[model samples]
Target: MQSFRTELENPIVERDIIELEQKIRLFREGKIPDEKFRSLRLARGVYGQRQPGVQMVRIKLPYGKMTLAQWKRISDISDEFSTGNLHLTTRQDIQVHFVSLDRTPELWSQLEQDDITIREACGNTVRNITASDAAGIDPDEPFDVTPYADAAFRYFLRNPICQDMGRKFKMSFSSSDKDTAFAYMHDVGVIPKIQLIDGKEVRGFKVMIAGGLGAQPQLAKVAFEFLPADQLIPYIESVLRVFDRHGERSSRHKARMKFLVQKIGMEAFEELVKEEFTAVKNKVVPIDADAWIATEPSETPGALPAYTIENPQQFEQWKKTNVFEQKQAGFFGAYVRVLLGNISSDISRLLIEKLQPVIADDVRVTVNQGLLLKFIRGEHLAYVYSQLEAVGLAAPGFNSVADITACPGTDTCNLGISSSTGIAVALEQVIQEEYPGLIYNTDIKIKISGCMNSCGQHGMANIGFHGSSMKSKGKVLPALQVLLGGGTMGNGAGRVADKVLKVPSKRGPDVLRSVLNDYATNLQEGELFNDYYDRRGERYFYDLLKPLADLTTLQDEDFIDWGQANDFATAIGVGECAGVVIDLIATLLYEAEEKLLLATESITAGAYADAIYHAYSCFVQSAKALLLDDGVSCNTQISIINDFEKHFEETRRFPVSNFKDMVLEINKQEPSAAFAEQYFQQAKEFYKASQQYRANKTAQTVNA
Candidate 1:
């Protein structure tokens, strides 16, 4: 570990790893609180798994791009630290399970040798920034969005503004209006656009904000029809500033940015963002598209291997489903459909070693948990196909109905209720064996999650299922909440699937068959799945599949969950998707002091919006601490403000005209230099008074 510390070139990253090591030691020594330690580790990408004493490490891959060397490095790390299996997640990140918590720093240090990162991959920070797998090679793209997505990830990787926010923030970049990256379902979604400005073409983005998916899904609203690409970073920064200050904190369910937009309409959110612009350092930070371009290789393919297809039928099917022609002339893009997003380390190594000659260096991890190999010449397609098939990776379905998306349900997730992976495999088998014709139908997307947090993005699937349970005859059985009529409508628009019915997990295959059979029998020609769903509505499908939901028809096998040996038990562990809450008064005050120091730093940096938000947080933390001392507990930030006004302001214990007005002024005032300084001063004074008041009150109590 010390040797790794010396090898790191970046001083800040070195300090980060060292700090994690120190925190881990403190936590083990019982010096740090469990909740605080959890928060710290989660931010560092060490997640608690269902099994005791093991961690699930999420490796953040910016836009899911990985070179052969980086992939090999991860494979090696997985073999050393975890089971020799790599799991791809819906967020375009890779995860490995059952790792010792103490060894994460060492693993991270090793990954960083290849410029790979795991920081902010989990917890209430900005997760991985994803983009279209076809961003650089998409034919319909106005321009490639890879550099912009890369820039956003780079800017926010260790940025102080979002390090300890109320909840996680998700962002995506779509290559074009087709929205392959599902921009409509992110905190901030951007689609590249070219506008004719004064007889010249100008590159910009169509920006959408505050979209999210969970039990409650909200499609993003358009923030700008065309925001200049140069102003992208500043606009996002201002939005983050507003979210950090005013977003819900105490309630984990409502902590997402979408709820913030819901509480204060989109117009109000926009106004708050406008108020923050004056504080941003660079209003127009231009993006250089050429900074990282996939230029054609100087040394082209030497010779094509003479490969004979073993299964001509399967190879042709593979060509139809998995192969894509890139925007680059004569070059092709190909996909490797990893079943259930699980690839063995040996297979991953084979992909790196065997596919070297035929495939290009540019490899992208697709959102559907598959690998996208770019820049394959037409002549090498057969060779590449043969090599992929040799490695048992040449599955024909790429984002097709046969390719099912699922989370690692009871396999490792703490929050998993039923077997998402097991049911996913069964459903895919049904698609392959029973409804082979639907493989060509890419309109209907099927996604499944272990639980309703939508880690599998079940909320946005045309046909989706999430792990659940039901009671019948005084016995609990694994169940799935069947969702239908949800999918991307393109151009920052989508639908959240309605939970139509619940059935035994074993009946999951029957549900897919019933839905597809109905659609196949009663659909009009050229009509899409969503249109058919809208025409038939939820009740029609409910009636069609209601028989399967009958509890009386349960069999003994239904008691056991998929991929499990024993009868089901609804044992849901605490989900650390949102960082654990910390409410101790001393801890709160310590945090307040730290926040004040951050505020002072932001003010020094001329990041006025950031400074204002930090000051706002400082005030809130101080107020909450004192309020807690007074035995007044509030759930939300806004409620805390109002409660403080009622108890402290009205009682004349706090010297403020109105507490709510003072704290909520973050959204009201422009983030100008003068206002920011004045507001920060008021916050500082308030914090000082709160501390003194608490101290004096404690002294009086002691004296009595």
Candidate 2:
């Protein structure tokens, strides 16, 4: 543990690692409550796995971009700490499983050597900021969104505002109107736009807000047709502040930003966001596009690399499906379809070794859990293919019907009910062997999640399935809730897949064969899959595929789940997806004191806006701590403020008369240094008073 302390270059990062190590030690000694410790570790990207006593450390890669050295460093870290297998996620993060909890700070320290991070990759804080893998190189893009995404990632990485929100926040930057990044399903989705103002072409963004995918999927509403690029960060900050203050907290299921927007209409949400503009650190945070340097090919354009095509047909197919012409002429963008997004450390190392010379250093982990290599010279396409093929990284049909996306269901996730990976592998086998030509078909997409949480983005897939279980003749069997008619409509609009039917997990292959065969046999020319499904209607597909759901026709093997050797039984553990909810009064006061410390630190650093927000958090946490001690339920920060007045102030238990007015000043006034200082003092006084009151009550109890 001391090794990482001296090795880390950044003082803040060093302190963070040290804190985590200390927290882990305290947790082992039962000094920190389980729920409180869970929340702290989750924000730092250390997650509890389905298998107890091990962790899954998610490495946050902003927009999935990683340099060659960073990629190699991750592989080395995986070899040393985990199972030597890197699991890429749908959110463009790489996760390594089965790591010892005690060794996580060391693992994170090693990753930081190459400028990599695991911070905020999971939990209630802002997860990894994702963008289209082709963001910079896409021909359809208005401008490169790489810098903007980078800016957002940097601004919010350890920002005080979103540290402990009711639920996690997600943001995405799409490359084009095609919405390759799935902006429509993120909390804050940004699509670049160019508007003419005073005969000048000015950069802007088409902003969407409060969209998310889970059991209940909501498409983000268009907040602005064109907001000046300079105002993007401020707008996002305002939204975060509003959400932190008023978002639902008591119910984990309804704690998402989308739910907050749904509870209070979009118009109201927008008004709240506008009200917080004064409190935002920057009124206009301009993004310098030129600051983000595009990765250039290291090799000078010269003679083509010597390579003999062993099979020209295979090479041609690979080229057609995996290669695309980038906006930069004479350079190609290549995709490598990592089956189930699981690539071994050895293969990853080999991939870097073989492709480093020919390709640019920029490698993007795609949103669909694949890899995108930018700036590949046309002359070296065959050589690139040869190298990838040799390493088993040359699977074709990247982002096509054949390239199925699936999450690790029963494999590692605690919330997993059935085997998403097993079913995905089975379905991919069906596509490759039976519907081989579907690799060229990009209209239809197949995604599967372990549960309805949509980690695999199943809610937006053209053909999606989420893991479930079905009862047949009093026996339980793994099932998949088949969903249909969902696809991106482009330009911040998309459809949520309708729950069509449920069938046995063993019938998953048959389900796909039926759907694809039926579509292929009776398809209209140039008709997309969703359009075809729409024309046929939901009932039509249900009737066509319902035969597989018949319990009477179930075979002996149907009782078993995919990738399992024995009979199926549901085994689920407590999910730490959003971290745990801590209701202990002692923990709340401790956290409130911690918030005051943060507020003081922010004041010292001259970050007035951050200090004010931290102070505001202190006020809320202090109020909530006292309110909970009185058996009052505190769901939202806003509710906590109101409930404190009702329970403590009204009853004359606490002396403060206008607690609401005092705390609401955060949104009422600009975050000036003077105001920040005043707010910090008020918050510190409130926290101290609450502590004394609690101490008096404890003394009275002892006397009684």
Score every model by TM-score.
0.93, 0.98
Candidate 1 regions with alpha-carbon error over 4 angstroms:
1-6, 295-298, 303-308, 596-616, 634-692
Q: lDDT per prediction?
A: 0.87, 0.91
Per-residue lDDT for 337-377 in model 2, tens only?
99999999999898888788889999999988899998988
Per model, state how many residue pairs clash: 0, 0
Residue-by-residue lDDT tens digits, candidate 1, 383-489: 87888888788878789999899989889999999999999999988888888877777898999999999999999999999999999988899999999999988
How close to the true structure is residue 592 of candidate 1, measured as C-alpha lDDT?
A: 81
Best by TM-score: 2
| Runs off by more than 4 Å, candidate 2 | 1-4, 301-308
